[model samples]
Target: MGCSACLWLLLSLGCVWGMGRRARETVLGTLGKATMLRIPPELQNLTLHCGEAMWKRDTEDPQRKLVLLKYSGGNYTNFMQGRNRFHKLDFSLEILNTSRQDRQLYEYVVSKASEEEVWQIQLEVYEPVSHPSIQILSRVLANGSCAVTLNCTTERGDNVSYNWASQDLSTSGLCSHNGSLLHLSYSLQDASIACACTASNPISSRVVTFNSSECNYEHGGGAGLRTEQLVLLVVVPIVTVVVIIGVFVVARLAMPRASPEQEHSSLAEDGTLHTIYSQVQRVESPKKDPTTVYAKVMMPMV
Candidate 1:
């Protein structure tokens, strides 16, 4: 039968059996964790006196029963699947290694002396949230104001919602949008702000913090530079100057040099010089044209 028809039938049975009370509850369970569905204190006595207690799942197959407990003549009997994973203690149910498939609507039925009591519970199972991480999407500096965009995400989480908050709650400059995507704009003169991103589900939560000053550096536009970049800027030019000076000194030392006296002595010993009165006579060349004349040279005393 359909779920609605099954619910109608259950309601009809409760009415005909003179149901005493009905209670509704919601329980949250984390994946792979144990959770307890407890019977209210006021209903514990009624459950103990009940002749039959059943835990049924509300689904297309309304006859699907998860657990059944019967008490007769001071003896108790129970039926369920996965005996190792589920336990009943004083009418309370404990589930271990919960999974997403365990999320469902369940009904606890108790019958005693021709009266019935029902507790309808809705189970919501969620994966525990992992540590959230922040990614800087973009950063801009315009007119002394810095605008940064960030995205908050988790590696593993189910049914998680994101919330952003500032470490300093009194700060008026903090702003965020789009839940997981945060956009913040602040003046450079403002104090550095720390932002926290929380990823939470019904069962678990995780938070991550980021400093706005991390994105304050602008590579081409802003005047601010990271510490390492500033160190490079200062140390690189000094290193270049030292290298240039060393190279100039090495080049100067590699060249050959001579003293003034040594230069003069070398020129004299080569004998490539003559005095003005060294040539005394000129003779005509007989083997050549008569007009051609040659001079007879003589070396002057040094």
Candidate 2:
């Protein structure tokens, strides 16, 4: 009877050893396949939440371990449950032994959850900076025949809408939002105006203004009108006076002069006038010699 009992005990020991080896091989073999690795969704975030539970193991004893809990994303503490619950709990099923081979599996689970959480945080932060920027496209002149365009561009917002308003009474137009640009066109008169653009999202709002100067021709009339009138008044009269003076100077220099003879002829034609003219002509003519003389007495003495 003693021998039989010893034999049964040996057989049982062998069976238990075989089973443990098989379980280790199975787990390791699945890891080697790469495709068979299973990761729990809950363990994805490497960061732990407050009061989150984790399995902790004793550095000296491989079998003795306890649950460690986290109170926040970073804070961790021992899981101190009542004895009744702690004793019945199984650590083997919850905690896998940390080994060089388990690193990939652990990282894979944590990375997925962490990525999702990070994306959510980024989206929340982006909401406030998503407002659009307003740009002055063009403006009309004072003639009231021209139209001006204003553009509103969204910087980071999605599905953005725009509102535009002008302070000028003479201007009237509608605002249309297309993608990232807002367009507005209006007929301009001589008036000062202010334009504003409001960009809105479901969570936030922003506004921008394009204020026109009081002297801006596209808006309305102001002190600029008086300045223009003064320039025209001062310049036009000076130009007209200069042109009149130039015309008088040119006419005086270009007139023809009468000769002295023509003036005398126009006065009268009489015999005394003829005799005076004839005597003057005679005095002005070249004179001729009265007679010629010659002597030949020197040749007879030689």
Clashes of each: 0, 11
Please list the C-alpha lDDT of all candidates, in the order they appear.
0.69, 0.40
What TM-score would you give candidate 1 relative to the actual structure? 0.60
Candidate 2, residues 1-302: lDDT per residue as tens digits? 69978755654443333221211111222212221222233222222321132333233345553333323344334353421112112211222222232322111111122222110100011233355555444545564544555566567653467777654544434433333343444444434456667777654668766555432333222234556777799988999999999999999999987799977765544223222211222334447433233322222211
State residue 271's C-alpha deviation in candidate 2, in Å.
Answer: 69
How much RMSD separates candidate 1 from the native structure? Answer: 12.7
Work out how many backbone clashes candidate 1 has: 0
Off by over 4 Å in 2: 1-127, 130-133, 139-143, 154-161, 165-183, 201-203, 213-302
lDDT of 1 by residue, 1-302 (tens): 99978865655554456466788999988888887776775455455444466666665566766554454434556564452132344666666667777787877777765777888888898888988777766788888888887778888988889988877866633744438888888778877778778899887889887775544543211232344568798988999999999999999999989899989887766664543433223355446544433444455536
Q: TM-score per candidate, in order?
A: 0.60, 0.26
Of the candidates shown, which would achieve the greatest lDDT relative to the real structure? 1
